[model samples]
Target: MSDTPIEFKDFIRIIGRGQRAGRTLTMLEAEQAMSMIINGQATAEQKGAFLMLLRVREETPEELTGFSQAFRAHTPTSITELSVDLDMGCYAGKRRHLPWFLLAVMLLAKNGKRVFLHGTHEPDSKRLYLKEVLPQIGFEVAQTPDQAKVALDTLGFAYMDLKHINPQLDGIIQLREQFGLRSCANTLARMLNPSNAAHSLQGIFHRKIDVKHRETAALLNDANVLCFRGEGGEVEFNPLRDVTLHLSRSAQQSSEEVKATCETFITKPQELDAKQLISIWNGELDDTYANYGVVGTLSLMLVLVDKLDWNVAYQQAQQMWQGRDKTWPVALPKYNLAAETFDTTGKHYAH
Candidate 1:
């Protein structure tokens, strides 16, 4: 076998240069790089250089596939027979307020679907993150691959940490601070699908990046991929506008075939105040935001699994949100000020 350590150094050398000299890494090469990243073979300087080079030039579909392959090889996969393996990793890291993915996951999971939410707590701009909000919402954050699997089977919502899933890649979290801007790995990290899910719902920030995300999804052999630029890159529901969705299916299937098999909907943002939004998130509002796009996304999953009609899928989502006010428990655990006080920078929290 090729010496693993030397292989990583060579991989770094290829990516460290500003120019792309060697051939685009094959799936195995990509996997090896990911192994190095997760295993911590690449030094901080090497990591920064590699990420900057890739970000400036962007990665080809093959390179993205390789990176993804490496990511999955190192990270543990949480398997569940649920029809859709939804990954909500929108880039607007943590914002100034509560996380929308937390609410969306709760709503989706309450309806008998399996959801995989993976992210890190590296705070930039603000400290709000799913890691903090999920536990408050009664979902346990898994600290290990085995724990993540058990959580997926039992709770239907599994929050996988990058540090836990892929430690080498996780090591780069602090490096971004030194560079003062995000690198290619930030985007690639979001695209990592360890579950090897056939279907995915990924939120991208920039329209240009969305294009790359779609292309990469195709390269990864995803059966169905929904890529969109959400408000502030927070995959949170915006009831006012239809969260734009770009649908892509594998090359093996015609676009017409996939389009014919899918369902689509348009929704307006439900009027809600900050407190009302939080309440709605906590399943407290009688009719906060219908969260139309989220519903539509789930409906699409239903169509994939059962071949359900669009109307049926829509109704299924409608029914879930209809009486949500009454079904959700009114008494939820209060947010601990002590916990929320810690900022993402590891500094004192201020709100």
Candidate 2:
């Protein structure tokens, strides 16, 4: 590695010239550039240019792999024989809706699966974060790596804030609101699995990025990677319809070959909008809604991680939801969407 500090001008020169040359940054170069950018070593102009160029060109899987490696190197890691380690990275939420991921984590954790969710609550027009949501649900959000491991050992789930876990990457999130677009760092952040779990379920809004993620995960030789499009650009779990689920295994299968084995679920959007959908997350819905799309998604995760049969996974999730309280067993207060006021930038404020 070069010992010289990457100056702002040099950073701009490389990316600017690379753009003109129709060249992309190599993983090494991308790592160095991102490190400099995140560390506040780059000037405003350099940061703006780097983000804009990357957004327009998008990131190659190789660059993304390098970016993920760089991110993980700085992020805190925990070692545990967790049966199921899930990375739920959907930070942006529906403008006026609540997130179902939090509820899903609780239900899954209740059943003795170890789940870890990583995210930063800094999205534009930020909604509620796992930092706030987890504590309300009786899980303590850890402030350090050791604290995170301790929490996970005691509780089935733990929330690791990006800022505390990895401040450099957290700084990248701060740039998003100013840049008005997501850079490669945002995409790579989703792939940063500190627990080093072999199974991962990730959701992205842009369908095209799935290919990039697939290629990146393939390059890293990921064990099992499932990328999909979420409901309404939010990473919420929508039961009414089957979201696009892409499965990648570390077998001798090509990307296309692996995708062919995937089964699609298609449902009516209206079905998802029905009160039954809300009840599922709130724990008020019945088993009919269970074993449906959301449950099926959970089942797919189980198959990927523990090699549990699909039917078995489906039944387990359904039975757990059935036996739980109608409302989420946790004491977190319901998010009153109608009553909460948010600024244009997405910060929630009590009116």
Q: Write the per-residue lDDT of candidate 2 for residues 1-351, one digit (tens) a residue.
A: 266765666645655675365577677777787777656777777777877876776777877887787777775434323333665665554433334555566666666777777777665444545455454444567776677666666666677777776677777777767876666666776777666776776767676676666678777777887766654344444555444555667722233211112234432232122233346666554443333435555655565566666557667766765576555443434543223332223343210
The deviation in Å at residue 160 for candidate 2 is: 1.9
For model 2, give the RMSD to the true fold. Answer: 5.9
Q: Name the 10 consecutive residues with the lowest summed lDDT in model 2.
A: 252-261
Against the correct fold, how does model 1 do in TM-score? 0.72
Q: Once model 1 is optimally superposed onto the true structure by TM-score, how far is the C-alpha of residue 306 displaced, in angstroms?
A: 5.8
lDDT of 1 at 164: 70
**Predicted model with the maximum TM-score:** 2
Residue lDDT tens for model 1, 1-351: 255446455776676554556445566676677667667787766666667766666677678877776766665434333234665554355433345445556566666667777777554444456666656544577887677667767766677677776666655654665765565566666777555566566666665666777777777777776666554465543444444455567733222112222233433232212333356644655442335545554555455434466568657866765545434433345563233332333332221
- Over 4 Å off, model 1: 1-33, 36-41, 77-85, 94-97, 241-244, 252-278, 281-315, 329-351
User: Candidate 2's C-alpha lDDT?
Assistant: 0.60
Report the number of backbone clashes for model 1.
6
Best candidate (score: lDDT): 2
